[model samples]
Target: MSLTSPAPPGGGPLRLRDFRLLLAGAAAGQAGAQIALVALPLVAVLVLDASAFQVGLLTAAETAAFLLIGLPAGAWTDRARKLPLMIRADAVRALAMASVPVAGAAGVLTMAQLYVVALVTGTATVFFDVAHQSFLPHLLRTEHLVAGNGALETVRSSAQVAGPGVGGGLVQLLGAQLAIVADAIGYALSALFLLGIRVTEERPEPVPGASLRKDVAEGLRFVAGHPLLRVIAAATGLANFFAAMLMATQTVFLVRVLGLRPAALGLVLSAAAVGGLAGALCAGALGRRFGQARVIRLSALVSAPFGLLWPLSYGGAGAVLFAVGSGAVFFGAVVYNVAQVSLRQALCPPRLLGRMNATLRFVMWGTLPLGALAGGALADALGSRAALVCCAAGLLLFPLPLLLSPLRRLRDLPATATAVTAVTAATEDPGRAGGTPGTPGTSGAPVGTEAP
Candidate 1:
């Protein structure tokens, strides 16, 4: 369970007990989230009789925390033991989600209560996700990062594949309000699984005179200064904005425009996520064959055009088009995510992982609330189908940032940030350079290069 210890006889991060525990916890948590993804909006639209704008606002509430507290969460995550933080976050989310069912049973559930629960759970999720990503390096070797991330994504994608179907069924059988009880139980189970992880993470060393503002600023500077990271952030942020639009409006379109019931809606979502599961399965192999940089670039470019199919979708047989388009986009997204997230983790210094992830999240996810609001407004002004058209257009444009960047010329990403810095420095000086970028004689070995 120690950081430097060898993996058990089998290959991959799964061979490690701590990693298995972490993966299990993630699986449980993601499954619950997927269920809530279906149940929450249904409750708002169905039971609460919320308008399109109101539903959009509720969706916005779920992600607003990333914009509000994202940077500071990273700094705080770095300063504490990540496992404990993750555990506490799960507990907080469980309590928040559990209240919904309680309120529903008491005949007191309202849009206001749902908003409060969403906001509270969203805040907890910000902390949990930051700590979770930061904690991975502590349990696995550098070489294992891709496989580790791939495994996590696989579990997440699997949950996405199954959870909504189950959630929809639960809603059909037990109603939306009662269906959320599953998410509460899921969070509680995730906390228990995490409690079983045996790895002991040491507290991060305190920096002298390090204020929260300074720490936040340092993380931002690092992300902004990195050429590839900046481009990745931009691409991801842009994609997320449109994705948020889809999230905000999809339920309305499915129910009002397409006239699908809760059960059928879940089936459609599960089908869409099948592509994400496939992408997660293929990510590691694709990275090895096509190169991570190429995969990152091509994944979005090739699949994004399918998003145009979303707005074109109609009822009955035409609904299948929505699933097809969504599946293709989800596939591309999962592959892009696995490759880029592994690259970021490999490139960052351990001391800065929390802040680095937090900063990037703020940039990428901060757009979500705005996009949700936009989607809602569009749905009100034009219609759900029109809102989807705008979202599809935005998705088609998402890959432009990556395509315009140096990633277009590279096969693999740089081994580390230090290697990138060295190359940047060398490129700037036409008169002096002796060693190759990753060679020992260069600036230094890649900052986070680890023993196999």
Candidate 2:
């Protein structure tokens, strides 16, 4: 298939064979990931008898690669074909996950092994995610980007809706060790599906005298210099920081503080994901109705207050408060993510797609490890409920960056980076003439949009 050609107009990217394959692979991979999200911590808590801080350390390990290799991964991804890189990532993740079950069967499973697997898989994910986002523009037209992203998010959300339930059931029926086997199988299936994509991409043309450091710096400059991107990055980074705290401590809180079993815990998570699913379903329409830029701020403003419900949750019917709060927060996050990510993809230049994504991810996701450590340490120092209170307060503060930025005044984001820069220049110096704005760049669209 030709890389320059667009999918047939009508029915979105779903009608394309290659897109279908990609979506199928995403479905497989996301389902497994959701399962591991539940089973991994369960293994640490249930089998290894990990303490609160140890569980936080485990969560930090899973995301530390983003801080360590995030920038260079983007440079490498831009230098290689994305499909093969994604396949290799899936293979690595599958193998890593498979080792857990094998080691458990051999009576040698330990926190050390889990940490190694988390680090290895997290490194692979950095590459896979950068490549996946960079590859989409080659497969579909600019107009299809939002729809394509929405479709992928829909499958992911659906998996979140069901995968945790299945994982919990598996944990109850089979041991947590054996339950992880499902994640390995899912990655294997994802790899197989990726192999079926027939689209061929030419190798990226290397820049003359290019060094990795310079390339990485260029990506950083592009994001940092952009007025809108800076605000979006700040908001997202703060949100992820607090979200990471929640991730690191939520299992410990639910399992110990609330006294929930594995099965009940999964159901609560699944229930919370319903909001993400709804947000995915409504994102495209919301963007159309409320302008994407406006929606971004509105989503955050609406969701911030709901976070207080988490620390207030208690046993029995009051537990529903936690689920509702989480659901409301997730809904806002998904909507905010879909709008901002699509805007980012639209604005970036073709050659800089990989670097732009990588830079943004580094800025946004790099805080995860720090947040995890803080959550773990805080939980150990204070009680788990106290830690939850801190995270909830942090969540309320996440929207401050957006509310204070130019996004608050704009209805829709400009379609191109050139336009954004031009507008900024015009606003700063009213006497000078800025160039005419350009249309949205058709370089690439985002896939695997950030999870909250």
lDDT tens digits, residue span 180-228, model 1: 9999888999999999987666788788999999989888887887777
Worst 10 residues of 1 by lDDT: 439-448
Which has the greatest lDDT? 1
Error of 1 at 136 (Å): 0.2
Please report, in order, the local distance difference test score of every candidate based on alpha carbons. 0.88, 0.86
Off by over 4 Å in 2: 1-5, 416-419, 422-452
What CA RMSD would candidate 1 show?
A: 3.5
Tens-digit per-residue lDDT, 229-343, candidate 2? 8889899999999999999999999889888888888888888889889999999999888877789999999987898998999876777888899989988988888888777
